[model samples]
Target: MNWQQAQKDFEHFLLIERGLAKNSVQNYSLDISKLINHLSTNEIRVSPTKITGEILQHFIYEVAKILNARSQSRIISGLKSFFNYLIFEGYRDDNPMELIESPKTGRKLPDTLSLNEIDDLIAAVDLSTNEGERNRAIIETLYGCGLRVSEVIDLNISDLYFQEGFIKITGKGDKERFVPIGEITQNYITQYLENSRNRVSVKKLASDVVFLNRRGNKLTRAMIFTIVKNLALTANLNKNISPHTFRHSFATHLLENGADLRAIQQMLGHESITTTEIYMHVDKSHLREVIKDFHPRSNY
Candidate 1:
């Protein structure tokens, strides 16, 4: 099939068959679009089925100059998924990316803040303003429950179970999990919703959304980043922090305190324990302590 037709079909498959979210489908399409752009720029005319592994490899090499290792790896993965779909649909005889190797890169550990640093960051918020209160709740929920930025923004008031001491989080791929929320965070969110959020004239659609912008709309991912960056600057934290840092910190802190890895994996909404194992790497000293304390006859 032609590049354009293949892209259209791939999008349909992702949305209709795979049930991927719009952003995910867009990302997959964007990966293939990069190859289409390369072909157009180089004046090479070839259909998707006719494309060879060598040509794809050359395109990836060209792309490596513009993207970092992680981004390039993501692009390769996306392309591989797309071609695999095509193969399933009988559009191609075999996958071209089967032999393509992602660049060798170590797993970069996420930056984590200590409890005192977290308290300092929260204290730095200017509560005199309406947005400040909402921002406080945002940060608290992020750190307290180990939530992804998307999950935090998309959080609904109905998802909260303060009486049960849990908040239902809808994670990647629309998977839902209940995470325990501490009393401190629960009170902060309650105060923000009751005082600040109540004062704003929220839009009809955003009424259920827990966090809102000044215009009474749901907060965007960029807005969350801006809030966190400003707070980090105010607190004078040397560690480069983001919303994900809070999540990493939450998991790291829990793991350090001897929380079960499987339980943390469930709370973090990770489908596999392997993904949760990253936290083990974050605290080698904690692992050593565990080994010393738990191993039989360890006194020696």
Candidate 2:
């Protein structure tokens, strides 16, 4: 099959069969696109079904010059998945990437804001404007609930179960999970809904959406990143931060405070405990505390 057709088919498979998010599917397609670009640039004519391991290895070598080990690893993984899909569809007999190995880039820890820094970031919001309460509530929900940027932006009014102390989150791949909402977060959201959001001229399409622009349309993912970026600048924080910093902080703080890792995993909507275990590596002090408190050799 042609590269273009193969890439299109792979995208459809990822979205329909794998149930991947649109953003995820696009990322997967990008890997194939990169390979196609490489072949065209080098004047090498090869179909998806006929592309050999040598061609892929050369392409990877070229990719390494432009990308870091971690990024290179992701591209390799994405390519592997694409070829696996091709094989599944009976387009190819043997997998070419079966022998390819990703670079040994050590696990990179996610950046997190300390509690005081989080407070400072929230306090930096301009409260005089109409969007002040809304911004405040947005930050509160993000940090308090440990929500992904997409999840917070797509949060719906109907999903708020205040009395039940939970918010329904539609996570990656449209998986739904109920995450407990703290009283502090609930109150901030309530205030925003009652004051800031009620005053907006909301669009009919975004009526159910909790977060919105002044035009009352649903906030885009870019807006969320901008909000966090501006807040970081205003707070005069030297470290680079984003909406996900709040999420990382949430899990790290919960782990530091002796919360059960499994419970944190549930609240964070992580499918695997292994995914949630990264927080364990964030705070060595907590681990020391555990050892001192429970280990039999602590007295020695």
Candidate 3:
């Protein structure tokens, strides 16, 4: 197939078969188009089916020179997925990215806020206005539940179970899990809903959505980021903070306070225990205390 036809087919597969959104499909196509452009610039005349491992390796090498390690890693991963799709569709016999190794980058541990820092951020909110109270509630929920930003925005009134003390979170791939909500967070949400949200003229479609913008539409992920960034600045927090920082802090604090790792794993919706183990690295004092309290020779 010609490049144009192959591109069209790939786009259709991404949209119809994979069920990816328009922007996501566009990003995948853009990654492939970059490779196509590279081949053209190098005077190589190989179609998607005929692309060899050596050519792919050279393309990655050239890309590495131009992009940072993280960007290069992302591009490589995107290309691998694209080529894997081509192989799955029987358009290619072998995957050129089979031997492509991602760059060796150290795992940067996620940033976390101390309880004081979290308090500072929440206190920075001006609760004089309706939107201000809603924003405070949004921040409280994010830090309290350790929710992903998307999960926070998509939260519905029906998902909250304050009496049962659980909030059902729908995560990636539409997977659902129930997380325990604290009384403080519950009270904050209750205040927002009863006092702030109740006064708003919410849009019909967004009536059930827990957090709404000034326009009464569901909050966007970018808006959440902007909210957190502004709050951090207002509170004079020097550390680079994001919504995910609260999630890290939540996990870390729980682990430090003698909460079981397995229970944390379940609450955080981590499929693997190893993913939850990262929190174990954050607090060495907790480990020392555990050994002192439980070790057989401690009394000696």
Q: Sorted by TM-score, highest first, which candidate order results? A: 2, 1, 3
Report the Cα lDDT for residue 190, model 1: 96
lDDT by residue (tens digit), candidate 3, 1-300: 766678888889888887665656787788888888999998999888888899999999999888888878877888888788888889987888989999977766767899999999999999887689888998999889988888899999999999999999987546689999999999999999998888878999998999998888999989999999999899999999888888899999999999999999888888799998988777689788888999999878
Per-residue lDDT of model 2, residues 80-108, tens digit only: 99888888989888888878899999988
The local distance difference test score of model 2 is 0.92
lDDT of each: 0.92, 0.92, 0.88
TM-score of each: 0.95, 0.95, 0.87
Candidate 1 Cα misplacement greater than 4 A, ranges: none
Candidate 1 lDDT over residue span 1-300, tens digit each: 789999999999998887776778899999999999999999999888878889999999999999999999999999999899889989888999999999977899878899999999999999998788999999999999999999999999999999999999888767789999999999999999989999899999998999999899999999999999999999999878889999999999999998999999999999899999988888789888887989997888
How much is 281 displaced in model 2, in angstroms? 0.8
| Candidate 3 structure lDDT | 0.88
> Which pairs clash in the backbone of model 3?
none
Worst 10 residues of 3 by lDDT: 18-27
